[model samples]
Target: MTATRVCALSELEQDSAIRVEVEGVAMAVVLDSAGEVHAIGDVCTHGDISLAEGFVDGDTLECWAHGSAFSLRTGQPLNLPAYEPVPVFAVTIDGDDVLIDPAVKKAV
Candidate 1:
């Protein structure tokens, strides 16, 4: 799997999500409230909206369009309107850079 550098760790705010593209795959990189970083599919399974534009609550990300909340670590939807789980990617922190492997999705 090819590891692509998405962003710098300093570029991410605490408890916020950022939109990124790795090899044409849209992804949402989140820095949860607990100061942990996670990478998941950017699109909301319930709608066509981007998850990075949603709200970050702890380890969960709430989609702004349909109000579907998803677990950052597992990519499982925590609410209705979204039954399918999003893909979760593997993340690596190399010094100040945040690297993501779009080809290496974490198994549910």
Candidate 2:
């Protein structure tokens, strides 16, 4: 797996998501309600918009384009318009830096 340092842990807010690029893959960095950092694919399954450009509430990340909400832990879509799952990558916090494994795919 290819791991890349995206950003610092302090840069993210709780219950919000940020759009980033890991290598060539578009990725999303989410901070849940518990303030844990999660990495997932940024694209929406039903649309071409990036998921990071959306909003986050609790553990769910909602796409601003069409209101497709996805679980941060499982990457499962919770709402309509998106039946297929989006890919979610694994994220690790190394001290202060946010490290991500882009190869792992999950529905986010």
Whole-model lDDT per candidate: 0.94, 0.84
Write one digit per residue (lDDT tens) for candidate 1, span 1-108: 689999999999998999999999999999987878899999999889999999999999999988999999999999998999999998999999999999998766
The parts of candidate 1 lying over 4 Å away from their true place are none
Candidate 2, 1-108: lDDT as tens digits: 567899999998888888898778988899888878888778888899899989988887899999999878877899899977777777878899999878866443
Report the number of the highest-TM-score candidate.
1
Error of model 1, residue 5, in angstroms: 0.6
Model 2: which residue pairs collide?
Answer: 75-107, 88-106
List TM-score per model, in order: 0.96, 0.91
